[model samples]
Target: MTQINRRDFIKLTGASAALVAVPSVLKAEIGSAYEARVVVVGGGFAGATLAKYLCLWGDANIQVTMIDKNPNHVSCILSNLILNDRLNMNDITLPYTSLQDNYGVIVRQGLVTDVTGDDVKIVHLDDGDTITCDYVVLAPGIEFIDVPGLKEGAANNFDVVPHAWIAGPQTELLRDQLHSMQQGDTFVMTVPQSPYRCPPGPYERACVVADYIKRVNDGDGHVIVLDPHPEVTIEKETFEQAFNGIYKDIVNYVPNATLQSIEINPGEKIAKTTAGDYAGKVLNVIPTHKSGKIVEDLGLLPVGARFAPVDSASYESTIRPGIFIIGDANDSGQPKSGHMANSQAKVGADAIIRMIASKSSSVDFVHDPARLEKIRTNSACYSPITYDEASFLTAVFAYETTNNSMKLVQDSFASSNSPHWNKDNFEDMFIWSESLFSNSFT
Candidate 1:
């Protein structure tokens, strides 16, 4: 693998200084004895990247504490490979050791229960501990909205069926279930509404599952995709070609097929859904999302919104100052994918560091001409059409000062042509992912 320097990393993420403006005066150059504390909740791509960049860019006066309930984060970036047996859990799991040992970031293992503050922020963890900070970043990723008739912890429940969206034991369980498929068995999966984790994820899963079934069962197997949206949400032409041409015989694409409920019996190896229930041998249901419990519990979400609304340039909560929300939990218009989250983290980290250096608690600094000049974030996704061929999409979101929201730059949107999947794109996927994984974790 070629070693990617910081500049290459920024370019690959599409968040270079030219694309996304940095404050004229950064924190590292403005050294001060005034210590500022930043407590980041959750250890996924967003939070971990924020913690890492904050430490790397901020001066010694900036102290960061990262808290995640789990010891390590299993990445959802390359998780689709789990279904095809192309990769295992270890390939995607990232630990926080480097953040603590190398960057002096304080890593804590605990669940945060509540957050309260007036000028400063106070985080209450479930373990009877409290964290006080000048700035609080909530990168808690996302939590799934429960569907009717499906219980998370019930015996032989969804876990047995496995969404595997978060990438962990559920991923392994779903992988094992796929392996047990018979020659003519069926694999059924549901796609949540748009604005879910990754737009191309469900279609990717469908393609890989169909590919696996075709390879193992001699093209006798079947795969079904039940999407609630009216059509493919992203990379429309690319996935349409894959479904209608490449794997047309084995793959069934159903749009506007919303999932209302589910019934499963592991013993019979059967599952049912409201969208014309079938006795598929395996089932995967990706659920709708809400901001993490920490955000909801703190009343950070706007009234009737599933995610916390934030300033696009700074990523600071529009409703709550001094509290920033990055990643999937924020209501930023960006896609809730790992790569996009990492991009948002950089923007958030820079804004936070600049805020502290100026000793300003309010996010009004985001409006300064220098700060607002070229705020943008890039989102790129690679969808595997088969085990060896893939297609990709890229979009750049620039902050519009008028409405104070991020909008897709018309000229910055591009995707691989339909029916153009190839080995080179597939190989580039690994290289891109390796760069992302290394940049975020280590």
Candidate 2:
């Protein structure tokens, strides 16, 4: 992976000047001879952010059509709060109305069956609609693989052992289950291996559920966290303190525990794992993930890889040009979080705008030094230790020209030190999420 610290990117690129000046210049030329139509698939963080930026940075002449299976995006960012009753589903939901009304983006509700074409892009929707465009940005989030004995549509399937990872109907189901836990009832959840969506997500969910059980159930509730990884993947110290210190009595942390299969029995949840058999009242199994079906169907992913390989600078697929992959679907070597996806979308949107204005015919716009220099992305995640307290971690990545990749900046790497959890951080988490929600949706 090639990268530099965020400061280095700022110093080399004149970041502020270029970001502020270049968009206006491109916006000025949008209607003249540089008009372009761009189709964005998936209405998650990456696609929504890219569509919003494409319209904001590129003037009215640039047409952006945003497509998704759902009418709006239900954010996974703070979905854990739903389980604890701290937040409702509507609290994190974002409608495409803002993107359509505010940014002049055309929001369409449909599934993209196929993305094809070379010079001129072609997107086929499941509803028998085909859209031709100059470029296509795909940010379809993630898809889960079938675990043994737990095929998605089986009679006793995910609806019972809800993953609640995608933050939709499943989220509500899990939230209701957690809310219904009685005193002394056990709640069990599994964490998949790394490189999955949201590195710290499983840990956060464990913390939130544990917190809810203790406070709401009068400390009589039990929370079991089964991990497939050796240990906590991200924010180790903070979550360690959470599990071992505060909720030690109520929470059981099992490391090196690989989930073999799940057999859901009424009021008797059984998970067969390498570690041991765990029985609980509620079971949440987050199975392994792969690139969204759209990207996989397009053959954009390398063999045996869960994500599409792309140029970090422009987010253009290494195998196919003119089609860019962002968010959790692409292997950009960045943390697969909403914040990182939003950051990559900005760089991607800018690159597409520049390419359109330059009249580039080829899909290889990533080799341009000027384009690579301006790419910078930062990711921050705040994990709730309790209902009222939270801990934070942050890192920055910049495009490194020498190796042509994105790397984490050593200096920008920061996390809350000892005594990481605090009420102030909890407050900041909401503010941060609101900013991201607005940037991507409104």
Candidate 3:
């Protein structure tokens, strides 16, 4: 992967001038002549942020419409708190009402069935409705695949074992199960392979659940974290400190525990993995992830592909001409997290606006250095290691001219310093999440 460090980025793009000044330059032209019809599908961070920016940055001349299956987006950002009773479901639930009332975005609720077009695409909804637009931004978050051992016709069947990866009804189910754990009881959860949504998410969930059990159940029960990988994926030192230092007794760290199948017996759910057979009162099997079915159905992905490839600068599909894929669905070499999605949305929104202003395809827009120089994206998220303590991870990504893809800036990766989790970081976690929530939703 081609990359540029902070020092080299400054050498090439003049740091602040390239990242900051170009927005002001683009805003002047975006407000007047760009009368474009853009349709954004999915209401998660990427779609919501994209739509909000499109309306916020573009003037009345730009007409933006958003479509989602749900009336509101229940954020997976901090949904883990729901399990530990630190935060309620309502706290993380984001509504589209503000996008409609505050911004002049047309919010439509329906399932997108099909999208067909070349330059201008027509989006078909399950309700038998069609919307033709000048551009389409697809932000369908992710779809869970079937793990081995599940019964036939039971794929994504959360009734038996609540994955709860996507925050919604299943999240409540898992929350209830976690809350009901009594002394000496066990709670088991699995971590899928890398490139999973929210790299540190499974580890964070283990930490939070362990903390809750210890604090609530008088440190009797244990939380088993079964991981397929040999070690933690992200925030290595911090999570190691958490699992080994504070919550060691409460958390059982089982490495290289690959899920083979599921076994259900009398009043027990067992995860039969390569490590061993471990049973729990409640089992959350986060299956492998893939781009939502829409992207596959639209033939945007290569055969046997998991993520749709896109030009990182513009987030437009390399397979298709006009459709732009953002968030977890696209292969941008970025961690799949809400904050990352939100960051990509800004760059994508700006790219779309610029394309609309210039009447250029995303391929051309990504190639044009003058236009590409205006691109920059940063993704960061704070993980709550405990109820009142948290850890953070951050990275900067920029379009590299050599590779023509988004690459992590060398020496830009930063995490919580020594004693990674503390009270201040925990408090700042909310402030950070609130800022992201407001910027994307409100």
TM-score of 1: 0.92
- Cand. 3 TM to true fold: 0.93
Model 2 TM-score on a 0 to 1 scale: 0.92
Which candidate do you rate higher for lDDT, 2 or 3? Answer: 2
Root mean square deviation (Cα) for candidate 1 = 3.8
Segments of candidate 2 deviating more than 4 angstroms:
1-22, 25-32, 152-156
Separate clash counts for every candidate: 0, 0, 0
Per-residue CA lDDT of candidate 3, range 1-442, in tens?
A: 2243323432332222113125567787555676889999999999998898888777677899999999999999889889887889899899999999988889999999789888778999998999989899899988877776553333544777888898998889998888877899988889988788999899999998889987899889988889999998888888988889888888889999998888766666899999999998878888878898789889988987899999887888998878899999999888888878887888788878878887776467546787665566766667888779888776777778888877777877767766787887787677677777887898
Model 1 lDDT on a 0 to 1 scale:
0.80
lDDT for residue 419 in candidate 2, whole number 0-100: 69
Using Cα atoms with residue i matched to residue i, what is each candidate's TM-score against the true structure? Answer: 0.92, 0.92, 0.93
- Whole-model Cα lDDT per candidate? 0.80, 0.83, 0.82
Q: Report the number of the highest-lDDT candidate.
A: 2
**C-alpha RMSD of each candidate structure in angstroms:** 3.8, 3.9, 4.2
